[model samples]
Target: DQLSKQQSEGDSVIKKLKEELAGEKQRTHQLEDDKMNIIKELTVQKEKLTHSEQALSDLQLTKQKLEDKVEDLVDQLSKSEKNNFDIQKENHELREHIRQNEEELSTVRSELTQSQTQGSSRNVKDDLLKERETQVQNLKQNLSEVEQLNEHLEQVAFDLRTENEELLEAYEEVRNQLEESVAGNKQISLEKTAMLEWEKAPLETELCRAEKRVLEEERKYEQTVQELSSACSPDTSALQLEQERLIQLNQEKDFEIAELKKSIEQMDTDHKRTKETLSSSLEEQKQLTQLINEKEICIVKLKEKSSELQKELDKCAQTLRKNETLRQTIEEKDRSLGSMKEENNHLQEELERLREQQSRVVPAPEPRTLDSTTELESELSQLHRIKGHLEEEIKHHQKMIEDQNQSKLQLLQSLQEQKKELDEFKYQHEQMSISHTRLFLEKDEEIKNL
Candidate 1:
């Protein structure tokens, strides 16, 4: 709209200037000739201005597209952030499971300690046996629940890994799209610039040709005026009449010359304005080219980052495999612990049965032999040793559980750190994109304003 207004005002000024010229019979003939030439020159200048305007509009459109592309990238980054958040939540849940398992392990350790302390009491053997059997059953149930939860957690982890992979692929696609758009914009601008330059060259050449023709005609008219003056003599009324007409014609030529000078001055001004516009447009083109170059570099960086992320994904996948293997080892250890508890239960039953037998039997001469008593005593001693060995195994398993828990904690921490780093990189990418867009927009507006 603004461009049209400027064009309309230029037209109105040209009309007013045209109207100001004399319409005398002596003047109209040559004035029309000059006016026609000036109109052609004006049309040529208008064409240049139109080309500049078209270029400006094209740049504005490119700016709008870049902004839209940046906005889309921002949206994708946000989605990636959301996915990371979900993964963090999943990690937190896994941590919770670790904590619960740790607590259960501690409870089991304390119960085992209490049972060991009470082992010397013979009267409570039956109670001890019953308690051990019950505890073993509870332990088995807990292990089963833990194994189920671990399977669920593994599935969740797998799902998260797949999601991360999908997001990474999506980001790569977006990056490629952005790169292609930048390339397209660069190509389009180059082509338009070439076309405008090609088009302007021909128009300028034609304008120069017209100006030269007009100059040649003006020179011919001057020569004819001089010849007509020389033809006129003071002796006859016809000659005097012819002389006066020539004088009027000369005066009209003077007027036309003055208008020509003014029009030439206007042309010079318009030419300068056109040059400035072209120079500014060139500067904008340079900036756009630089922006495209920067975008290409950024795309390269994005590709590298994607490659790094893929590596990280592979590492995570590898870690998950290790975790699965470790989980199997831990489950196997739990099973061993369950079997040990069962063996301890059996041993406690035997000890209780021996205690009951001892409490009921009398040391009669024929029924109880000395060797049998010694054998029972030796068996009792063996059971005690086995109990001690089972306790040692339980302690070793507990230590292993503690170590596994620590490893898990470390793994979780490392994952969190990696996530933070990933977030930081994404944020930096967003910031750079925004800054680049803003700078390009500022420069674009500056060029157009110029």
Candidate 2:
């Protein structure tokens, strides 16, 4: 009976050992599978880390390039500033030169006036003519200078207008880009936020499931702990292995959570950068607005100057017309003065013949009455007074004619300048038309070829 009892205990112990061995084997197999899965996941994570590192390197390179370009632009801006300074210095020198030219013009005008006054008294007609020609040449030079200054002013206005247009176009482009970037960034942010939120929702659900699984695993672990406490010493190692496996799983979960948190932090940084960029764009927009306003003011000033120039041009035209009319009147006066001189010459000859006749005649023995002698003396005084008046009138007419001739020469010079300007305008128009025609023809030919 004791041997049977011993055999029964042996059988029970052996069965218990077998069951523990089987449970240990099952646990070891499960651990092996878990290890393989962890290894695969680690490899995947490593690959992802490598790709992220490469992308970061590329982004860093791009940032470096952008910084370099910004430096180049700054250097270019400095160079442009120096060029502007040079241009300003040149403009100041040009203004000084113009002032000198004006002084020279004034001096020439005074010399011309003196020469005109002395023309009649000058014995050498040839010298007077040469002097007059020189004066005319000087006046022509002054006119050319004035015209050149006018052209320069016009060119400056054109350049300003073109620059204003270019600035407007650039401002518009920047504004459009800013608006589009804002819209695009907002859209991208919304989409990314939505995507992240959607992903987070799934992750939360999965996390809840993982927590429930963990709870179930904890229950299993507690059951194993209780079983180990109640079981033989041989079962303790299997229970310990199960506990270690659970710990490893928990550590993996924690690593995944940490990765998600890092992604969330990166998203936050991106959102902040977007906000900063938007603020910078707003500042740039404000600057562009101010620039546009300044350009508008400049354009307004240019228009006012153009109007003033037009008024001056009109006044000049009116003066020219007045000069032409005065020239005609002076010519008529010259003809009248010539007629008066001829009449005076005839009267002088008649008076000389009467004097000779009076000398040849015997003394008036018939003795003229005092009344007859008095009448003859009165007529002679009246004729002398008429002759003096005619001489004064002739002198006045000649002076007026001289003045008119000078004015006519000035008007002629102005007319020549106007004609030259007109021709230049016509030539420019023709060039523009020809270029337009060529472009159109090229387009037509291309269309035909197509």
Best by lDDT: 1
Alpha-carbon shift of residue 74 in model 1 (angstroms): 18
**How badly does each model clash, as a count of residue pairs?**
0, 0
Residue range 167-249, candidate 1, lDDT tens digits: 45554554555455445444444554454445445444544554454455446445543544454333347545644654565
Off by over 4 Å in 1: 1-122, 233-362, 365-450
Name every residue pair that clashes in candidate 1.
none
TM-score per candidate, chains pooled: 0.49, 0.34
Cα shift from native, residue 360, model 1 (Å) = 9.3
lDDT of 2: 0.44
- Across 1-450, the per-residue lDDT of candidate 2 in tens digits comes to 644453355446445544644654464465456536534643543344344335434433543443354344335434434443443454455446544544554454445346434432122223433443453354345334434533443443344344434434543443354344334434433443454345445445544554464455446545544554455455557545744754564465456446645644554554455445444444544554564455456445545544554454444445445444544554464455456445544544544454455557746621432333344335434433543453354344334434433433343343344335334433543443344344334323322321
